[model samples]
Target chain A: MMTSPDSTGTVPVTALTGLSAFPLTPLKDGQLDQTAFIGLVQRLVAAGVDSITVLGSTGSYMYLDRAERERVIRLAVQHAAGIPVLAGVGAMRTEHVLAHIDDARAAGAAGVLLAPVGYQRLDDDEVFELFRAATGRSELPVVVYDNPSTTHFTFSNQLYGRIAQLPGIISIKIPGVPADPEKARAHVAAIRAVLPEHVGIGVSGDAFGAAGLIAGCDTWFTAVGGTIPVPMLGITRAVQAGEPAKAQALSEDLQPLWELIGQCGSLRVSAAIAERQGLAAPDCLPLPVQGLKPDQRAQLALMLDRLGLASL
Target chain B: MMTSPDSTGTVPVTALTGLSAFPLTPLKDGQLDQTAFIGLVQRLVAAGVDSITVLGSTGSYMYLDRAERERVIRLAVQHAAGIPVLAGVGAMRTEHVLAHIDDARAAGAAGVLLAPVGYQRLDDDEVFELFRAATGRSELPVVVYDNPSTTHFTFSNQLYGRIAQLPGIISIKIPGVPADPEKARAHVAAIRAVLPEHVGIGVSGDAFGAAGLIAGCDTWFTAVGGTIPVPMLGITRAVQAGEPAKAQALSEDLQPLWELIGQCGSLRVSAAIAERQGLAAPDCLPLPVQGLKPDQRAQLALMLDRLGLASL
Candidate 1:
């Protein structure tokens, strides 16, 4: 049902399923902390995430320059240790997206993720044409990143169906699913009905990832998992091992972090968690993206400790 | 109430009042069409616009790299001919925004526009910190650009009040006012009540420019005005000369254009108008941002002709 774009052994669409960790490209005084970033990558690889996606929203892709993005892409691939690396190649212009895609491919990325990073509020036609251009230009399998909170462009189911038909679109990273079980299943079903069988449904929004996976999403493109992949992998393995309750229980244990993420966004919360755990440099997020204040970080630390995750 | 940052004789806050036209940085084969951009600046000067703000949403600022943005800023200031060139200095990172401000100031721009450009859904504190950093880093008077339709970060009036207290914030560029005259007045008044007396209220969203002016907004930060300054000037001057009826009438004559703009975004419509009027290269907008289709262009041309705007 799916075809490889090249013989470089790029990660097949089937491999796109399961937990894909999105790491923070932590910064040190406005410069990429390469050692810290590599540590994050090695952590993901050691934890055995299904894929390593850099330059995602959690990765602060748009904040970095092209050279920095290329460095990230290259570093991610270099350290991934045979784990498939996907790069987020989104920019406001299609040309930049294509260039980023080329960078990803050159860096040996298994796939590239594209969000309709917009400043000019794009329409359906413009978005479709962007994917058409990217898929047409590169052989790397593409992942459609639908992040309305960040990109501010909502994709209708019809639009998703249209873009899914593009030659190399291997997955759609949806925002989230409903909290209620039946409703979540219906939501996933609505999207699944439109997508080709081989095209995977990867869910974002860390809080709802377990629900999404239990409802039939193939992957959890997660923010928290990028920093602490164990609990997330527990949920994913539980789901894969046909224990939905176990997966939900694993997810429920991290409810406080999810609540904090709901209060502060997932990016900042994840950064706080990483900094608290000594995984990244202090004050790791890129500016003007301030991480949690001292009090908030303390609260997060306490929550993590209570959840038995402070040592992670 | 306002003190000049220095004797650079930068455009004062008072001068920031009235129509500040936002011109498109039309591209030719993925590069800045410098000549076309200068022509746009010269046209605005000849039409006597109060200020020329380049690299706003219409200028595709986010799509451009640092060198390209610097070029645009330099060219705009060089060609604006004393019309108080204001450059939009918004980027996702505070450092980049500061860098852009430095570039704008070095390029001899009178002021810079700051939008809370976000990828992580920034909070009020983060947005405030960004403005604080920008204003603190440079003496360039800043305009708070609140175009949520593009930036996706809505500024609460309280946030406006907080940011306005910062030194060197000259104006607040609001998206639009309410349609009903009384409601529009009330809306503007509500914002005015929060802003410092030195900070002006500039309205964007071209269709509502006339009403915004009549409702006591100081400037119409417009897209269509950049392409066809005559009628926009007519409306602005009428408002300035205390002829609200005339301003409303002139705006009414362009209703069809506004309707089309509502259908196709103002950026694409403005690009089409520039191309139609032989002002810019064919298909002038940046890649992925397609210009109007042939049929849409034809309809636009007919409307321009019908409104006596064809030869401007």
Candidate 2:
């Protein structure tokens, strides 16, 4: 499945399962803090995350230019040591996305994640062709991102099936729907039935990762896990060991962070929490994107202490 | 006004006030066709376009990586042969954009054009900060882009006044609303009143460029004009020479190409038209975007013939 274009890097295409960290791409003085980034990736690998997804939602791939994105990917792959690295490759233009795929392969990533990000309203055919063309050219395996809120395009069951059949596509990241559990279950079940046996279903949304994991998703695509990885991994382990009650408790432990994330979105809340914990550098998102209001940070501090995550 | 970072490359920012070509960014097998791009830029300069926008919307600025965008800007500036070259300095991130400004300045560009291109809805404060940050860092003049259809954010009257006052911001690109004639006139007039006298208002929309010129707007931002520069220049010359009817007729000549662009978008239509005109190499916008179907190509050929623009 994940046939690395280079023979030197051989890892299973489905290696990115269980708990994966979409780490915060902390920047210092308007430039990437390479040491901080290397520390974050190495932390995830040491903590035993299934994969390190560099330039994920938490990593702010949209904010980075081509050179910065390539540098981030290379840093993640190099410091990951033996751990698998999945790079994010999303852009408004198809050729730009194709170029990112080529960059990911050249950087020796385990796989590249893609989203059909464009300003224009892309029809089903356009979105499908986007994936078809990207996967057609890429040597690295791809994880299709179905982020309707951001990309404004959902990978429908038919589209998912079509993408699943595309060569080098190994996974689909199904974003969480906290408001409708039944719909989420049905959606995942329908898509799972259509997807090939080898292809995996990853669950995004720190708020709904436990529910998704319980609903038979293969990976917990957590934003909080990227900073405070222990709780996320604890939930993953509980679920893997068939202890739903323990997983439920661990999932409950993340409710405070998830609630804050739900308030202002992960981009701000996660960075604020990381800054408070002293795990990440200041200003993850660009300026004018307020990290967290003073009151919100206070609540987050109290919650972190209560959950024994203040020292993480 | 366009103080190139390198002192050797001095050009007035207002020099880009006439017919300016936003050229097709030709790619051969997914790589930038340097020869074709250089030839296209050289052609525009030779034909006497007031400016050559290296990474305009037609050039697919959103699609190119930092290295490619840099290469394009550098190549255009070098081959511009002392003509002013306005470089597109837009990116989803602030630092990436700031980096692009440095790149454009280092590449010896006359000035840089910017747009609010973020993944999420950037608030008024954020947009202001984005410009303030960019202008504060660069020696080059700035052209604020207000393509709401593409950027999903309109530069309001307040915003126009605010950005117009920022240091190093010499111009603003006001996209013409030809469909709503009354709205277009009032919109431009309102912003013109607020803007500083030093800041020029350039008009985008090839179809409405003549009306914009008549209405006191400065530049004719043309996409089709990049490949067929003569007709666009003829309109500008007519407007400058105080012949409104001639300018109108010259603008009408672009109607057919604009109609095709209205159907499948500029990325498809421009590349197709450019490929047909032999102004660019085949396969400009990656695969599956398609270079005009046979019927569409036939229609385009007829339009080019009817306008007597076949040799342009």
Candidate 3:
């Protein structure tokens, strides 16, 4: 639920209070698999996920040229069928990110997600200005993504406090590196205490959804949830329904997949899972974004079957 | 000591058996410090450096736009005169790198240095294909840059074997992360053994230059040497003349500078050092590519004095 753009020209979003999915950008023969991508989004919508995010790390936003990125955002916003579609607007330069934000707003994106990604390592001031520059210009809600796994830059709690003061920031994706149950919950709760009541604090660890949900993560900023929506929903719902055992069991079932995802981070792993599960085309990703190796694919297949989600 | 490009498009040259300077790209009011950049090259040449490398990490190539990058390459090549000017051609896309290669060749660059710097995490095949796409088309000799600190992608010995088989590749810059003298030496020797006899193995640790020289580094690929070249020559000459005491003294003098460089990384530190040393304008760099903090700069100034390099 989006309340439209604010007076300051930023999108004012409804409180994101449930599971959200970030779908992989499927490709065919090095071209985006638009049909498969649309189908994947449809699945998430049918599963009643809160929102669908596009152009995340799994989307291979870095690998594609600017034209391709603009096209993806346009297509995602068009096909999302009124479900709020958040577009990742990260780039190497501040101007580049601003350009993407312009495209996102034009393409009717509900909001934009940003991660501090570039060639140079930024200090606190640089990183802050990066967010401010983008948020200050965009007419969409800004979700500050803190995925140090891919960006290789960590935003301390203190840094996040400073970032929260930016005018257009509607949400912050808390990093979930130490995704253990206790650690993950403690981390989420600590950040939740600091964020404004109106702003959302989402959990990024797909495997640790139960813990995060139990600990009051407003949204599950997730990868697997985007591809296979049912199980992610099950885990979140079980926790929300006050059934800790059910939530833990659903989370436990996702452990095997999480183990694979842990190796090279979520994007690479989620891209493979989506492709194998027929949610995306066979050649759904370009070079440098290869699927899981044969043995790993087999492991994934077996895990999916054991969890009764092979078909989904 | 460099030979011109061969008929086969491979850069040919005399063995690089001495120090090579890699100067930072100076900035003034968000513009290239043309006067300072040309002056930096003149100083390197005047100090009798064996070769010069432009657009390295110290050059902040990643932070600048393509137009800015092309200008730097053109300026460096024009001013380097007879000395070999190796241009960094790393970019997020293969086509972009390919375009830089063409510019490097057209600009009269003696060679091209490359790093695996796309946003995606590269496997062996992706890295190989990245090089092949670049080297397969470039007319200049290729120098493989293996700085995991910036790129976050390390080149293993096995991967280097595959990379070595490429035609235009004539040199490899061994990583200096674990900059311990013995470990660095052992690492360089291992790579050197794998490379063709004519193909040089260079060391990139600016602080550990004499140590690398003593350890059999044919080329001291350095950042500071590109600015204050005389001291680098002194250290290398001492090592070559079998004067370990003299070499050790020089290395010890550089230790303080290296300590500061190690804290944030050479790119940021070198950018500050070059600016403070009056090689570039004060406001050349925009956001993100900042100089060292106050205390670090003080430490650097003291170290430069103790090393008798303060005047430079």
Candidate 4:
């Protein structure tokens, strides 16, 4: 029900359809390999992804120095080539957020995804303040990101409702609660019902709940979309067009890879997948996160084979 | 009994005693306020702080652009004179850690305080690999910071024992455990018994634990020390010199301020106190973290007045 902010009464719910990949920014010999990054983006776009997120958690935004972030954003914006490039703009402080916004703006990003400030526990008012401050600084449309698993804080329904009223907020990316599908569905429905018709609510958890999200929200943010864009796009398109059987069937095909990834650690598994897809070099996870074990990798490959994504 | 690698004998067990203040890196508009930072360092040193840690969590090292981080490190090193300056060198990836070590070396930091590459959970081997890589990169002594509250993963005692064996790891700063006297004594005994004789164990939590840490560990890392240096330093010195009565008297004067901070939020309250003490600018916390409430501010002032530290 989220409507578009533009004059058009009809919400341009750009089928949050298709694969929305968060491509890993390649680092070679201790520096960002722009060539590898551009090649990766080109492949995603060619594979029929609808949108791409740059500088995501999977992209290791936390490690990138400021200049490197700027360069990465610029490259992503350039290679995205008219497909909306959503730049990640989360930082520990507001000044850094502002700086990132400036970089995103200069890179001509279509919109920015803002993560909550600080990794500490915060009340709703503080969360509102963070979004307000970020929206005030950013000229571009904003997409609020709610990924509680990494951030250690989740947005309450009331907080989401309040944020939906903000002028600059165009969309929200809600990560499906992994432990309970029913609660995730309820959350999506609640957010969708409360948000203005123009605001899009996208679900980010891959195909496991893609059908439910497509049914409840406006768009779906997919991790697999970054590498295997074609089939994901097919699934989303079918879901958006109300072809439930086709969508469900495709999700089944995609479910194996998702399950494989679920078995390993979060970002590490994602990075490993990216590496397998030739989008990145070896998975070079930072400390406190290691690559998957050989058996796990074999399981993942088997799943990839079943999904017809063996090339990845 | 953690003995030094060199013939320093039993690592001096210098009762990691005293108020170790981590002064904020001042900012003017958007840039590093070098003059203000230097002035603050001079004040802390003059106040008789036992040690100064620059580029700490309170110092906003993560938000600092690389050049800014270098500048801050250089400034802290130059201003530190003879005082030990522990440079914060935590990052998401090993490469970034290396970059931080290079900067720390260039700045002539006495030691590096490392936070585990956070935001993900790594197994034991990965943790070992991270420390091994870091130690290989730095020649200066290292202080391992085990702040599970921020890192989301606690360092196992076994891991600490392993890290203690690594070259260059001279100390550790562990927080969030109970701050009770008996508990503190037990923790020190346990860690000291396992760690090499050269490793120094430090305690970080509420200031009430400073005495306990002096009795238990080799050092005490205090957030309060950044604001009220004189009393904390006096208390640590008194405790170290086996003057329990004097230490108790100093603790009585300092206890109220610590309690007031406990009443308010930890980070905000500490930052507010630092601002009041003229160590940092008022209302300078990064986004999502607001300044103290008026009542909290008043209570802080009252505590400072009772301690006779308002003017100092």
Candidate 5:
């Protein structure tokens, strides 16, 4: 049973079940578009997302300045109201991570999902030291983020086993096998076998294997969920309730949208999907990332239409 | 003849020339190590450096939070006095670049070296758009940084030619071919042929081709120059005066030290050399960077001793 850090002094590690949507941070005239962002958050909340994650790679956190990140987190917290908001706080240095952690706590973040040093490969000791320092700095629970494809360093199963034991670490967010469901299922099983049952394990390859990851782990994080939260949330909940047929049908309805998003690259795809759903502007990326191709946008629109989510 | 932006009632494009050393911004206990940084700048100035470029990729700019970057730039301007300080102002977004440009100008930077987005791959138009936006935002002359190896996006001759006509851009900093003098020579010739003669071209390969690049182009930039400024300044002067024998002799004397510094990766290697020379502390990296290896350190010390820079 997960307990609240505030109430029970041992917050129950809530299973991050259902669609955990990470909304793209909107930018207008070179600054955070808070009004648009808040509206998007409201829409996602209304659509019944299980949790909200801000400042993830999809949210363009790397491109945001520190002050902007703080403001975004604060806005997310306020708009999210009772929904849990997980702030992405990973950086190359432990000190930077600590600073972000402090900001996340002050901003009322429910937890922080940290990406390891993104630039270079870090040794096991350095990685451990980073987590130790981060956990020490923030009272809130931390989610160890391991996306080797993006960060260029995957936390070995051994490292994950060690991190799993660290205090205040409530969960691990692993991106399911790069593109294969079978491999992802195996990875989920391997990670689940080692981690304590109380510590939730969430998979980030949202639409690809939301059902499988839900079957294997405790939660499913989806970029698409940020736009069409209801369907994804319904699918995950159904899968968890042992309604595999209903879950499969719902997932089928969501697959085209997910595949279309997967085509634009991670960050851009997320942002593009958000824009198509009226969650963000089309040109919301930092440098190095261009907007989606017209054909991709058309495909997304068609997918939304097929799912009867075009209006929302 | 390079003219000031204020000249002719139009922004005069001043070509940033000579070895523009981007010295490491030192930190102690999570705060800016102003004393150490200023001392390093003083050494660079006393050694007759043509210009001081702070917060480049070699300086770990990405790891620094915005406030830290601004603070470092402000301190650099204050300490640099008459020597022109070119602050590096590059990011993944146009606004971030604009903000850096504003900060650099406010800090009294002589110019801004704009690094293209380092993380993602951008097409020609996007790259051009980034430079265009930066140049448009800055009152000070902008140097189009073309270190593709680090940015992961090399500027083609066509792309360079397109942006070469921009109003504020006046130079390009090209890293010399690694361990290949012929390639270095070819790069210089090719870049120079396309870039206007008035637009300065600077090379960064430390001691290896400092003279060759100077012999081939108008100027050379050195990571080593920020620490052992006297020797680098001597070599630059010799090259400028067309004294190949003197320049070659100085280059030969400094070759081993440069090679040793080169052994460690750029950021850590530069920091290590700076610390060994008593310029900065060894642990001052912003975050996400590891220190030099034992063998690398010993090799550096040996080279310093052989070059009579052991006192450093």
Candidate 6:
């Protein structure tokens, strides 16, 4: 899976390609549910995800404290077996992000994801300087995370070009590609045209994974893959095996679940899925983020049954 | 300014009315410039403001760590010189927010401002529950801060009605009133209709402050007023004396400054103003938030001079 390094001689940028599962940091009794968390991580490892990313939006990284985040990073690295662990180190302040990066490096994380998390609306230059300071602070490979859904900061292609020029930036995790096949290819291609050859462009938003991959996204940073990795891996492997039709059909089969995820955020629905499958405690999500209503849970159960994902 | 008790007997809800200035937390060499911050507090007190609100978005509260926030809270209270100090205790997690409420209470703050600061977009129910937990945690009066520019979580009128039902919510700090006078009055009236009589409606966005005050808003939550309070107090006094024209004229005289604020955001503009006034050291803003470009600073300086605000 190694490729020749283009700029940052140390990091194999191609390692960022393929399925990177972002697992949730489940909690029990107002504390980190280590057993459940490890189980989730082990599932990703067993399903042979290309990389395991902890403390992402799916992981409720913002809700957890420093010590809790450190624990998640350590546990993820410890139980990931041989899978490369990428930890999210985003915080409201750049200094805190640097501290998280240090912790991730100390905990043996293969890379770190940095999002321009905002309270005050951030301008293009501020976001660029944040990445500049972050890349300067650590040697670990960096992924420029642009999730406007959570961070509320959008990245322009020009800004992406500016950031990718910095050393150690191995990937750019875009929010998603366009839904249509041709538009999605054009969108990813436009971004790819700006980025260096060594930096990979990964796609998020679970439902867009197959289209993004078939359109030439280097990786699919899947949220549901953390809890239900089998289907996600099926789509990923199908795309890798040059079976675009199979990948599209597999993705279409999960439309009901994606519809539910669209109704409720992926974070809550993923927690509900894990809980329904007996993979985590009933209330695995952090407080102020109750998973789902009873009716919603019932609907999710029926949807899973219809999708034949009830047993998975 | 004291008034009879409401549901929360201990908090003086009426004290939240009139002009409440939100000051910047200027930093020096990566540490809080306590002397500069105290001077800002003293300015508000000497200007005879109704209350001084510290640790707001203008204060860069989200960018600070717990220890820094504690220091700012303590220093603000210590130097407010008996002026009621309202501290922002908003965090991403309810538990962390509760802990901040504890800190604000311990620091002798007169009230606490809560905003649903979101990384994941919070639903109305979650925001309501957050306030319920916060009010249950402390006896201080609470101001529901609804600044969508920073928090990215908009509070609907329905959500405001729901949160106002909670005890200790003395005021709702709305983003702004409409620009048109008649529309502004109707806007405030609509919100007031949903709120309890005891709960006041405050307005933010410096440009809209005078319009809001003239339209029956109980308080003007101002960013520019924090750095330069004389003109702000003039506007407030004129409105109180039933001279809406004078207040409108005063607000219009500073259109240049408001335009700057609108362009660069209040935080960066306020920092630049503080730095220019020699109240705070150069480069007062924290890392990754460089105050302003040289051209913007030049424009701000000219605006201050044209408005005859440079001497103040």
Could you give candidate 4's per-residue lDDT for residues A1-312 as a string of tens digits?
223332311122233434467777767656787887898789777876677888877666776767888888778877765667777888876777878988877777767788774544566787888788777875577888887766777787778889978877878888764435466667677777788877788777774546555456666676656655667677777877888678778877766666765666446666666667666676544444567878887777777776667664
lDDT for each residue of candidate 6 in B1-312, tens digit (9 for 90 to 100) = 334332211223344778999999999988889999999989888888888888998898888888899898888877777777889998988888999998887777788898888887788888899999999897788899999888778888989998999988899999998898999999999999999888899999999999999999989999888999889989988998999999999899888888898899888888898999999999898777788999999999888898899998
Worst 10 residues of 2 chain B by lDDT: B1-10
DockQ of each: 0.76, 0.30, 0.41, 0.51, 0.37, 0.71
Please say which candidate is ahead in lDDT: 2 or 6.
6
lDDT of 2 by residue, B253-292 (tens): 6788778877767667778777887767777775434566
Q: What 10-residue stretch in candidate 3 chain A is worst by lDDT? A: A4-13
* Model 1 TM-score relative to the real fold: 0.94
| Model 5: residue A133 alpha-carbon error in angstroms | 1.4
Give the chain B TM-score achieved by candidate 5: 0.90
In model 6, where do residues sit more than 4 Å from their true spots? A1-14, B1-14
lDDT of 4: 0.70
- Residue-level lDDT of model 4, residues B1-312, one tens digit each, is 222332211121233445567777656555677777787778777887767887776676665667888887777766765666778887777777878888877676667788774655556787788888888885766788887766676788889999889988888787744556567677678877889887887777656545555556667676666655666677777778878678767776666666775565456776777677766666656556676888878888887787677877
Segments in model 3 whose C-alpha atoms lie over 4 Å from true places? A1-14, A31-36, A177-184, A241-244, A277-283, A305-308, B1-17, B31-35, B93-96, B118-120, B177-185, B240-244, B302-308
User: Could you list the CA RMSD of all candidates, in the order they appear?
Assistant: 2.6, 4.1, 3.6, 4.8, 4.0, 3.3
Q: Which pairs of residues have clashing backbones in candidate 2? A: none
lDDT of 1 at B63: 83
Shift of residue B36 alpha carbon in model 1, Å: 1.5
Where's the lowest-lDDT run of ten residues in candidate 1 chain B? B1-10
Best by DockQ: 1
**Clash totals for all candidate models:** 0, 0, 5, 16, 10, 0
Better of 1 and 3 by DockQ: 1
State model 2's lDDT: 0.79
lDDT of candidate 3 at residue A280, scale 0 to 100: 77
Give candidate 5's whole-model lDDT: 0.72
- Measured over the true interface residues after superposition, the C-alpha RMSD of each candidate is 1.0, 2.8, 2.4, 2.6, 2.9, 1.2
Q: Which candidate leads in lDDT?
A: 1
Better of 1 and 6 by DockQ: 1
